[model samples]
Target: MASVCINEALTDDELRSVLSKLEEERDKEMFGLVCKRWLRLQSTERKRLAARAGPHMLQKMASRFSRLLELDLSQSVSRSFYPGVTDSDLSVVADGFKSLRVLLLQNCKGISDRGLVSIGRGLPSLQSLDISYCRKLTDKGLSAVAEGCQDLRSLHMSGCRFVTDGVLKALSKNCANLEELVLQGCSNITDHGLADLVSGCRRIQHLDLNKCNNVGDDGISKVSQACSYSLKKLKLLDCYKVGDQSILSLAKFCKNLETLIIGGCRDISNDSVISLAIACRNSLKNLRMDWCLNISDSSLSHIFSECRNLEGLDVGCCEEITDAAFQGLGSMETKLPLKFLKISNCPKITVTGLGLLLGKCDSLEYIDVRSCLHVTKLACDEAGLQFPECCKVNFTGSLNEPDLL
Candidate 1:
């Protein structure tokens, strides 16, 4: 049977039902873009229908939206310019998505500061804003939001190279209620900006300053000293300036930390990891330390022995790790709280190292021992796949393990 169009004789409820079904079709964007009537009906009711529309379709849909509690437009990969797409298309997207509780316009290259200003206008209830990787965004555009949207609770400006400490100051002063901030790849930000924000925002729970090379011990010391009470999750990926002192400071003060990611922080040695794990061992749930070459068997052994409650861990490319350290993880008590584990390119991990974990940690649901060259088929079979997740295995020499449909 042919689908009933919204233009036909249909009540609002019937149109909504039809639109809901249309959303499931692969060409849902095309369905919304054919005419103004479809765009109007689809845009206003899109929260339930579509939240991940590509740029052109999103631009079209934004025309008729009057009220929205949240607007998430992150990770739109399509760069193909639709011939019909014009400046008016962008204007609609900016002007319509008003009163948003959360607005994520990350990676939208087409949107300049003008577009940002247009979007920020009249967004009185806007709380969470993620402009991460929007290269065109400048202080002027963001300042407008700081001056206007005072209720913002969380902000993600990662990869926003143009944004500087001025924006941070504005956010620290204006968005006082902010509880989460991600400043990854903002090379211009200094310790002053970081310290000011951390000291000011007492309610912050999660902070990601990954690849923020400028920040050193001075900045991190202030954050550790001040925001320890509420800071739960902190990611400092590739921040080379931060050393063991920062970790020690964090462990001493931020005892409530549940998730800590310190990937590519080469300045840290085994002592820092050991101290951090010891201090926050009882509370730490997820810990990732990828490419931290200085870490060795001693570090892992200490963390495993102490961080007994740890559930998720990733120690990728930590070449210094030795096989003996695996035994501490092997002795993990059952109910076996550890669920997720990733150990890639740790050369010493043969069947012996991995086998210990398989026999002991019965609750492990996700395991990535990829590139551990010595692991054979025999090891996999001996370590039974009784868990709810990742039951598929290649028992034979052939790596052709059939995926369960």
Candidate 2:
């Protein structure tokens, strides 16, 4: 490849094409500073903007990037954190970018229904909206979004505490094209709300209901019935009431299911897990059963044998898993070698058993065996030494050092 000169003169379209390929923020800024033409082209070409310096900065940038299509005003709690964007800024952003398609306002805690109303009325072309962790948002704010952005395909409202069944009803009626929804930690939502949402939004494929404690087996069963054919990725982390019955229902209908995370669903047993693995065997790729105490080696045996395309497996904190559990993976033949495995807190998994498992997984890249007392730091180091330098072995929880025996 020949080195390209930054000073090379190109048409506006050519500049836009070259600038779009630059992924790094610094590179984009440098490209803008290349020349007057480059600067103008870069400013007009920018469609996606993520600003953490609050809404005022975003407002200033909006003037220059008139073609802005996606805007992210999300906040973080890091050391560099500053005052968050408010309704005033959101209104400004909405006024500036009428063609905006995606907006991520996660953790902008100061926003209320008034700002959302403005956003809904202003950004009518919005297709994807992520307001997750914005605790101040209520049903009123959400209703405003549903009414304004009826063409929305993806919505992430996780950690919005005040949201309830009313919001789901509003979304179901308005956002019929909705394909992906993430309501993780929205404890106020129950079976009725979930059932209502799924019933209306039959196109929903990706759903994240993590920590939604109020939703039980009935709610999940309703989801399985309504969006089973379209649903592909489902996460139910710490959903205390969800158990084997929900899995069984999903297995029967969700034939195209690919990724499932039921971490902390302690009520899940071997039979239900095995049945699910068998049902979605061809499509299932990632399975995480962390803290599902009832599952043991038996479930792993069935999963490894049936789920041939399994690429990632996490059985962390599954106390019932012993050295015998890995025997299944070691014996099975897989087209795609398991790349990532997490067996953290599995006390019964010894160094010998882990080594055997590692030997079988030719493409294994990362393995976390933290808190496994039988697997010492020395063993982990030795395991890493055997594999190509690219592989990483984690044995952090154990304190025992190597002894010169």
Candidate 3:
């Protein structure tokens, strides 16, 4: 037939060219289904894959996808019923994917120090690794990765309770090019670990120390000073030991800080907030100060007035914040770029303040005024009806109107 003649006429290189032009995975897969030769070509060209982890499956993948760059074996979601990837499976990965650049094993509970040792010894080209919530991993395993994979750029070890200052020291000494580090809920790490980390890895741009209770002003101040120019996003949520000094240091040193999340740092007062608003006004975009008990109207006023580029603000649970904050926003000569606002659980904010903010900031995409004592459900319903379809407002627990019989 004509189709058979045309397929026979096309060279292997020409077939490969056609395959390269196909962008969709489904289309490429369809091309492979044409014949065994096309299927072989497709397997050779594949670079990334996500699959359920097992020693036999991984070995098969390794042999098929010779040029693979990324592998994701994260058992964080639906794979809870299955026994996750273990040290033996990791050894298969280490032997097969020596050129692998990214490996994500988040919440793979079966993987321990033994598994990581194979990863460290094998994948020297690794640039990003996420072992978050892998509770079995300890400092020994992480340090081995740091020592072996010097080109690492992003490392996320959130909820790895056993990781300590030893891994931090190893990272500082080895992975100088590290940029993004998340140690969220790694409760064992203290100021000493952070100091060791910043001493060498000064290029860190995004750092998360959320729930790191032992990390006080001293550790954060050191980070502010060391990675001042490069630091862009910082999260200090529920770090109760962090007070005004850390914020003040950030304001003074980290002029380019774009996103700051200091929620649950109750000791952060208006003075440091004001300074931060003024200092990082040009660069600061998203800020969350929820549960910051000491910051009030003055801090919010300065923030609204100075931070022209701020796109998100979360000042929830700050009992002192009142209508005065929104009044400042309404009075601005130019409309703020704020698209996300959360003022939930603030008893002092009323319908008047909500109205003022809504009237002025037409760009708002999301607003949460949940549990505001003075704002009625009727008022919220009215505001929702008047606002454009793009904006979403949450007014949960607001006073509902009495129904007529």
Candidate 4:
């Protein structure tokens, strides 16, 4: 693409808006070469260009793009493109972007707490920060965010191994309006820290504790106990330590629960599933229990009986379930409000059994029956005859899946 030449008379605000959309570093560099007028405007527009383009191009306009509001250096454009953004990059980032609100430095292995603290010192308007996969980030970096970023609402710190109970305590005390929190793959937080935090952050709505293997029933129970009324969205994916007891507590307390995703939790039994269905029957809109080994057809029926407003359901790889689940589903004439349904890799589902759901469930827009050997093309053809709203379908290694898209 040719360089976009701008009129010299255009105001500064107009120039900034045009420059913000440029995704490539080469485009910004070529803009200067296009004309003398453009060359002079490049100095003021450099920050907009540098923040959007990968950190590799930050050096080209390091001194200029100092007042950037949003900095997303999650991935280097190319191996040769990102020019090793070290601790030096932090100083330029802090000095330039005084109004920086959203900063995403994901997968930037070289960045540490020192660079992050510089951000806290520089930007008081920082609200949303994501430092996922930055293993070197310790309690110091988290403390800086809690103390410095007074308006912080969303914080994602997945795999920051050094973040401990102290960081949680600081966040609970300092960041009172915190609404969304993602602490996936972090092992440092314990029950004591989490218990204190849930009691403090009464406004927490969305929480993801995926793969935080260190958290046991004590921590999950504490969260369920403290934030049951406030918590609307919760994701406990791959939380191995979670069990029936913790789930039971959540089902009883969380009244306005909209979404509950608990995939790969091996300890969750049929009793927990029954309790969740029975307790949150009216409020539950979406429930995903993929790979929960102990769950069976009985719990699936429990969901059908209770959760009337379910929109999305994923019961993938629940091997113990047979045709009885679908039979129970087809027996009723009630059109499920489900938009997304996935029962992939269930060997027990035969052609007749699986066909019942596709035919009976009319509101389904997306379906996934991947790796079910017994399902045949004729069966799918017959099922698709009744429901035509399905826009997307998946058949991962299934022998006969004619309805699949």
Candidate 2, residue 25: how far the Cα is off, in Å:
7.5
The lDDT, on a scale of 0 to 1, for candidate 1 is 0.73
Estimate the TM-score for candidate 2.
0.86
RMSD of 2: 5.7
Please write out the lDDT profile of model 3 over residues 1-405, one tens digit for every residue. Answer: 444764678887888899999999899999889888888888877889998857888888898888899999888656666548889998999999977999998888888999998899999999999999888999999999998899999999999999998899999999999999999999999999999999999999999999999899999999999999999999999999999999999999999999999999999999999999999999999999999999899999899889999989999899999998877766667877888888889999888788777776788877777888787568667666355467767777443421210
Lowest lDDT 10-mer window, candidate 4? 396-405
- TM per prediction: 0.76, 0.86, 0.93, 0.79
Quick one: best lDDT, which candidate? 3
Across 31-132, the per-residue lDDT of candidate 4 in tens digits comes to 677666566667655433324443445655554554556677675636524434455677667766676778887766778889888888887888888888
Give the per-residue Cα lDDT of candidate 1 at 319: 80
- State the displacement of the C-alpha of residue 345, model 3, in Å, after optimal TM-score superposition: 0.9
TM-score of 1: 0.76
lDDT tens digits, residue span 54-159, model 1: 5566655555565556766555556423222222434565556664577766676666777666656757677888887777788888877876778888888888
Better of 1 and 3 by lDDT: 3
lDDT of 3: 0.89
Candidate 2 runs further than 4 Å off: 1-41, 52-60, 79-83, 329-336, 379-388, 397-405
Q: Residue by residue across 125-145, what tens digits does model 2's lDDT show?
A: 999999887788899988998
lDDT, residue 190, candidate 2: 98
lDDT of 2 at 134: 79
